[model samples]
Each structure stands twice: as C-alpha cells, then as structure tokens.
Target: MFHKVVVTLLVVSAAVIYADVYEPVYKPEPLPYYFNYNVYDDYKGANYGQQEKSDGKAVYGSYTVDLPDGRKQRVDYTADHYKGYVAKVSYYGKAQHPKYYGPAVTFFNQYGNGYH
Candidate 1:
C-alpha cells in the first residue's frame, strides 16, 4: 500500500510539472510605426505616392497612381484584427485618350527573297 501511494504521488507531481511546461502565456503590447514615399518621373511617365502607419492593433494607409488614360487613381485603406481590411477608392481627374491617326507607313513585303 505504501509503495502504491508513493507511485501515485510521483505520477501526480510529474503530470503537474508537464502541464506547467506546456502551458502558454500571452502578453499584449502596443506597436507603432509610420512610413511614406513618393515617386515622380517625367521621362518615364511614372507618378505615385504612398503613406502608411500602424499602432499594432490598427493600420491605415493611402496610395495614389497615375493612370494610363490621363487620370489619377487613389485608394485609402484601414486594417485591424477585428475589421480585417477596408478600402475607399476615388479618382481625381477625368480620363482621356489621345486621338488615333492613320498608320504611319504603307505595308511592305513580309517574305525575304521568297526563301522557304
């Protein structure tokens, strides 16, 4: 009987120690950061800008780009663990396409020396 009691006590102590080792602990802390950038190149016709910030729990940002049809496209967004991601899109200018003209030159022969 004494031996059985000692074995049972040892088993209970080992089980408790094992449970403590595997238990998880969590601590929450606020994280904050911000960043922004802009790019404009007249020769390449590239224009864009972006800005973003976060406070661990929530993030907010906006970005703008020059569209090919002579319009600016912008998007504002926010994200968090609860709300996921949401965005609002808007345009700044009207879109326009350049006038199309006739082909620059007449068609020419496609085959060279009629070689097969």
Candidate 2:
C-alpha cells in the first residue's frame, strides 16, 4: 500500500511540473494594435490613398493618416532590430477606410496600398 501511494504522489508531482514547463506558442498583446509612426515617416510619391492600388511601403505594419493636407497618408509598421518590433506590411490603404483593410491580424502593409 505504501509503495502504491508513493508512486501516485510521484506521478501527480510529475504532471504538475510538466504543466508548468509547457510554454505558449503565441504571445498576446493589447487590442487595436498600433505603432509609433514617427520611426518611419517619409513619402516620395504623391502620398495619396487609393484602396484599389497597393501601398507597398517598406514598413513593418501599415497606418494611414489624414494629414491637414488634402492627401491621405498611408503608413506601414515593421518590427525593428528588437523581437517585439513588428514591421508594417502595408498601411491601412486608406486610414479612414478601415474596412478596406482587415483587422490587425489579417492585415499586412504592402509598399503601395494593395491587399494580398
């Protein structure tokens, strides 16, 4: 009887340790995932927002800003040298048109504003 009890305790302890050792596959973050646009803020083209066209900017992620100017700004966010720094795939082709772009997960910022 004592041997059986000892074996049971050992098994239970092993399970507890194994549970603690397990690691998650993916890490979660806050919602409305965002980026600091200041890192990569430069435009050489018309700087316009066209949903049909691809906004293929070399960024970790994408964001579209409506500058005081008539033109709508599009941005992409990319992870930096650091691991957490996610690079923008493309901007919200039209920042205002969130619909054109999917949620942060499905969304990627292309050089232009083309959805893939």
Best by lDDT: 1
CA lDDT, every prediction?
0.91, 0.49
Per-candidate TM-scores read 0.64, 0.25
Instruction: Summarize candidate 1's per-residue lDDT along 9-99 as a digit string, tens digits.
Output: 9999999999989856777687899999999999999999999999888999999999999999999999998889999999988989878
- Give the CA lDDT, 0 to 100, for residue 1 in model 1: 100
Q: Model 2: what TM-score?
A: 0.25
- Weakest lDDT window of 10 consecutive positions for candidate 1: 107-116
Model 1, C-alpha of 81: deviation from truth (Å): 0.7
**Model 2, 3-113: lDDT tens per residue?**
999999999999999999999999764343323323323573333332222223222445555553334555444443345455333322332333374555444476555
Q: RMSD to the native, candidate 1? A: 10.5
Give the Å error, residue 2, model 2. 1.5
Which residue pairs does candidate 1 place in steric collision? none
Q: Which regions of candidate 1 are displaced past 4 Å?
A: 1-30, 101-116
